[model samples]
Target: MVEIDGMRLVQTRAILNYIAAKHDLYGKNLKERALIDMYVEGTTDLMGTIRVHHKSPPKEKENNLSLIIERATKRYFPVYEKVLKDNGQHFLLGSQLTWADVQLTETILMAEEKEPTILSQFPLLQAFKARICDVPTIKKFLQPGSQRKPPPDEKFVATANRVFNRK
Candidate 1:
């Protein structure tokens, strides 16, 4: 949720669309906007898998995490890879960045936190994530100590760094 002045916003997609509209990130035309919406929905579905992993019981969490990772890596990510392949662009919808790209980046980050090597098999998607992270604003936002969440597990971070060749 977001609060601006005296008004508040709820719902992830609604808030993202509102912000995208205000910032002209929705798209240049109706068809582009529709494409962005389609990708945003796809990202949301991916987020649902993360949510399930996070909410599973202690006894079930490990199994659930494995399943979530499998589904995300094997199923959802291929769809994104194909989209990027077909679009032939770094961004999801077109030549420019959109809310969908931003949402997908967040989903990728979440997945990486859980399974650091997840993107190794999907080079296009890996590059797509890197392209988004390379944006000036996003780079600054991702700098060390900038996020509120605790640091990722050391093992995961090490694995991710090794797989992605990050320092």
Candidate 2:
């Protein structure tokens, strides 16, 4: 477990990577493992940028969101798609599960649920999100009300609601 800003954050990606390595998910070579690294790094960059933008003030975020999504989809989404296109028997990397697959799937779903139109231009990405949600672990994590909203982020939410037209 890791603590970030007093939040007990677990290193999910590290755990998944360890599991994949132990389970022989990577192809039997260094190059194959490198490919998984590429996928994880790229996806992490995309999601991290999005997370930053999500927590930004609406005024700052409004214009940035489009650019953020555009760049993420153009760069990150296709990488995952190509990975899946080659190794997408079940997950982003392959029939075996990996951290890249889990992270990308969750990021895409959270994006779609919050802003459905962002990835509409990429059906493959949309399908990737759907496939992710269909996975047993992910499905369980996303079960109805399995997670709660961020306690309304009271101060921020109230300010944002007032800034926007939300009644």
Candidate 3:
């Protein structure tokens, strides 16, 4: 939860929506907003899998990782791929960047840390991840000296920098 000017925001989705609204990342129209919400919820589901995997026993980590990768590949990535293909855009919701795009990027980063090859099968998803990371503000924020919660692996950082065209 976060408190700003005496107002408190709780719940992951609620906080994300609030931030998106404040930053004008929620999309323009009602339909677009609904699409964004859909994708955000999808990402949240992927995050749930990640959380379970994180808390699982070491012996079970491999199985959990396999499950995560399978779900990401068979379930999540294809849906996003179709959305991108149908929209003919780099982002999840047409030509505009939405909070869903941000959430997907985060999901990709986490998945990459756990399974580096998880994105290889989905070219469009890979490109989408790169595009989100390529945004100027996001690129800057992801640079070497910037802080990242939980501190991403050095290899992941290098890969992200390369993908984003950042030094």
What TM-score number comes out for model 3? 0.84
Badly placed stretches (over 4 Å) of model 2 are 2-16, 22-29, 88-90, 147-167
Candidate 1 RMSD computed on C-alpha atoms after optimal superposition onto the true structure: 8.3
Q: Per-residue lDDT for 49 in model 2?
A: 71
Scored by TM-score, the top model is 3
Residue pairs with backbone overlap in model 1: none
Q: What is the C-alpha local distance difference test score of each model?
A: 0.83, 0.68, 0.84
- Is candidate 1 or 3 superior in lDDT? 3
Select the stronger candidate by lDDT from 1 and 2: 1
User: 58-141 in candidate 3: lDDT tens per residue?
Assistant: 678799989999999999988988999998857887788888898899898888878889999889988988899999988988
Worst 10 residues of 1 by lDDT: 148-157
Of candidate 3, the 10-residue stretch with the lowest lDDT total is 148-157
Instruction: Using lDDT, give the best candidate's number.
Output: 3
Error of 1 at 100 (Å): 0.5
Candidate number with the higher TM-score (1 or 3): 3
Work out the TM-score per prediction: 0.82, 0.70, 0.84
Question: 27-133 in candidate 2: lDDT tens per residue?
Answer: 46787678778777777777777666666676877776776777767877766666667765467656756656766776676566446787777667777777777
